[model samples]
Target: MNNTEFQAARNRPGVERQSFKKRLSDAKFLLILFAPAMVFYILFEYLPMFGLVIAFKDYNAFKGVWASEWVGFKYFSYFFQNPDFLVLLKNTLLLGFYSILFGFPAPILLALLMNELRSIFFKRFVQTVSYLPHFISNVIMVSMIIMFLSPTSGMINQIVQWFGGDPIYFLSKPEYFRTIYVTSGIWQGVGWGTIIYLAALSSIDPHLYEAAEIDGAGRWKKMWHITLPGIVPVMFILLILNVGSLMSTSFEKVYLLYNPLVYSTADIFSTYTYRVGLLQGNFSYSTAIGMFNGITSFLLLYAANFAAKKIKQVSLW
Candidate 1:
């Protein structure tokens, strides 16, 4: 192109690179606002990543991480060969899968239902009650579960007796652990989870609903045609994120609720890693297992994101 055309093209509407000083000055206010979060992330999250070297070494308390003998993949092979590996893997995936299946849709469903509610006061009341469980401490929450499900004098057992049925040990049964864990997670998180969907819902143009009504579309029809499609991108993004964590069951709930009797069904990766690393101080082996979990999670996230982008043109990236 000629200089004239080039000049005209440069003048056309688009971004141009700013001088370093100018760009920094322009973003200074936002940078200042982000300082605290950057510091916190560096200190609490990124700084600790240096310890990943432990996964490769025979970590020793006296010799320290750097001084410890490099063992290559010895610790990793040890974890694979461990007797409990398959059982732990099974439990973790089962719990996480069920939670995603049952728990992920809950917030979306609740938000949609709440949006349908015309009474503002009633909606607020339900939201408040639903979110209350999220703030409760895990220890207290598990304690409450134990109390409610106690075979001897628990309220649930009392109802069972009233129905001429025998009181059963809910927590001890191997078959019941996943159900109890997943259901309790839903109860705790579903309301709080709705908050994001509600925000997404707010961004929908009111005129769409008005236009739908003008077209003689009923509530269900509007939801199906307009509302559902409107929020689908958000739902898919969250679903992909949940898929990425298929190996991570919540450690606190499982550790608190499980016992030897239910270990066959409830022993998961995080809890096993905790017992091996922190309790037993098998640092290298535990680190290897933890690293494996992290790598799998990363792969799952990438796979999910790729699939989402290909199919729906939605992704975290």
Candidate 2:
């Protein structure tokens, strides 16, 4: 084709789409590699989302989704009006709040401490020991908690006996539920969480520390001025994510550990949904509650991202 024909082709109405198709063809190999993941998400993640419409409908399995009677937020209203709603909401919020208040900082502190260690062997050992617990399955972790907290034959009780104090029933007590859950969660996750911060710390230029030293800055001063600031962007980005997940608690841990005695403080949206939806077969009610939880999480995430972008010029977006 000559210049006139080339210009006509470029200015064609479908030129952009044709160009996009050409690009896709050129990247066909990459797309082939990515097809499995794309298919998996479409089949599992996105397709299941369509089922969420049951939240607004009565959702009779026999009636089929399309044929279900539209209740139009009836289940949502029911969930809100339920007598246990307030208690469940409070319990869920407190557990999540305690986790953020305690769990989020534990890793940051550990990462900083690990960074200060001059001995590579000792640092690796500490990291290995700390992260090993994260691999322990929730079932095993809960069992360990139960065994440790047992009033009889437990090491904790033996310690109490040695100290001439009564053996405390930790898991059975509603007041201790939040404390145990948050503490155990921190133990399991803190080391793994430090991975991101450690990566950020390594990216800091060694020159910054050397300059601080030349200025007669002490260890603490150097860390405060240089090291911390180097990772502030990463920290704020992570903080935004954590704040967004403030409504979500460890459902598996809570479900495994909680009983009727500790339900006052241990119940959460997931466990509640599991019982009411899966066990009792109240699909609509459970779907509404789950949807509510997801919406709140999204809103919280947006708020946190907005705040971080405004305050620190850092955000996930």
Candidate 3:
């Protein structure tokens, strides 16, 4: 049969579809390329899910996960009743919310400013300088923050002394913890975050800008009309992802930067989990807390995605 006749025959109800084996053989090369990622997720991500059962168990190390006695919702109830529960939840939510409020827009603003730079050399230099902080290890970054904010010997204190003002121990002050954490986080991640928006901006049609220029639109007008809209989809996707992880504050950075003095303001779910699970060996309770955190994140993700889809017609899915 000719091409059209063969296509018509294939589209008929009685025609059999291609077998799975046939399709797999046809795309074998592509599947081979994808195999490593699939294996990695299965091994590292999905397999660990089996251990989540420990959250419901007494979780004796000697008895092992499967052999441990199930305690149902005992740990969850214990956590709910704990006096520190509200404090931990409040701190975690406030820190996450502040980080999102400040850190989210910082990179976008930086990218927009970078895009407007007339000198290519200066733009590249600024980008490189900004991105360098992202590569700094959490330990090193926190240490630097401590050194800078030290009341007696720190640069900040030195500057204060030069101005004949009192030196403030910034890290030890509970009121300053959120601001310092959020600002440092922005410094570390802003340049890396700009990468996505910059990519989106690059893909905008050059003709749109040309047309805007011809219509007597200035730089700000063109940016407001063309540049911002061009990146809205990318912005929405990142925002949803950010909102989904709203409860997941950086444990490493917080642990390194905070002390007993700042625990009231700085203690979060992850840090608390670490202290309970590893330090104190209350594995069951820690696992329960971790499970609660995971569930909260999942719900946040779902809600954010749903809202994005309904309001903006944009979503990760």
Candidate 4:
């Protein structure tokens, strides 16, 4: 085109293209703000995703990922046909169900209780103490539990003996494994979990509470009518997220707390995968099992999202 025509086009509204320099200038601050997070996500999350291909191959240490021979789904078939699969599935689901049934409500209850506290000093003290356990390392927490519940000489067993009861092997008993694991998780996690609900509660308007009080509503009535209703959306959103991860349990906690005696009840999918893949050095087979797990998780998430949308009109997507 001629210079005159190009000049006319630039002068027209919507005719001129956005200059790269101007666009960059406008987005500089936002780009800077997001750069670190973008880098971290790529490095820690997306980069590792490339390794998932190992699951489809008979990965050899010397041959490496690209050189490994493709084995199709032989490992996955083995996992499905294995006798231990049913036991692992049952244990994982039962533990997860128990956690949801008991552990899910504990945080909500704790948050509600904290919201009701009138004294600022007492409330601060309680929250501070509650959150401490959440920061404790898993190794330290498991060690403390073992020491506290040791049948030979632990404080719990000693107390039971004092009351004319026999010392119970809490860790070794399969029947007690789920109970101990769930309760310990509750104690360690409930307080920190309450922080999210508490933040959601803070976003609620104070006027709602004041209006409820003027209408002859007491603490219980206000909580039931106002506070509970206010947090229902937050509760529902979090519940959806939780349901999406129903298969996952903290592997460290289970592996650390369980012994051979309680493995019948405590062995879950993650621990099982760790044993077969990591300890046994069946890298290809383990990768297949891991891939199966990822696929199952994806399916579960989609199913849960669909159910949520149908039943409550809430969903992740």
- Root-mean-square deviation of every model: 2.8, 3.3, 2.5, 4.7
Note the Cα lDDT for every prediction shown: 0.91, 0.91, 0.93, 0.87
Model 4 alpha-carbon drift over 4 Å, by segment: 1-27
Question: Which digits, one per residue and each the tens of the lDDT, describe model 2 over residues 160-207?
Answer: 999999989888889998888988899999989888889999999999
Backbone clash numbers for all candidates listed: 0, 0, 0, 0
* Residue-level lDDT tens digits of model 3 in 90-199: 99999989999999999999999999999999999999998899999999999999889889889989999999999998888899999999999999999999887888
| Pairs that clash in candidate 2 | none
Q: Using alpha carbons, what is the TM-score of model 3?
A: 0.93
In candidate 1, what are the lDDT values of residues 87-171, reduced to their tens digit?
9888888999999999998999999999899999999999999989999999999999999999998999999999999998999
How far is 142's C-alpha from truth in model 1 (Å)? 1.0
> 1 or 3: which has the higher lDDT?
3
What is the TM-score (0 to 1) of candidate 1? Answer: 0.93
Query: How much does candidate 2 score in TM-score?
Result: 0.91
Candidate 4 structure quality by residue, lDDT tens digits, 31-51: 999999999999998898898
Off by over 4 Å in 2: 1-33
Candidate 4 residue pairs in clash (backbone atoms < 3 Å): none
Model 4's number of clashes is 0
- Give the best candidate by lDDT: 3
lDDT of 3 at 279: 100
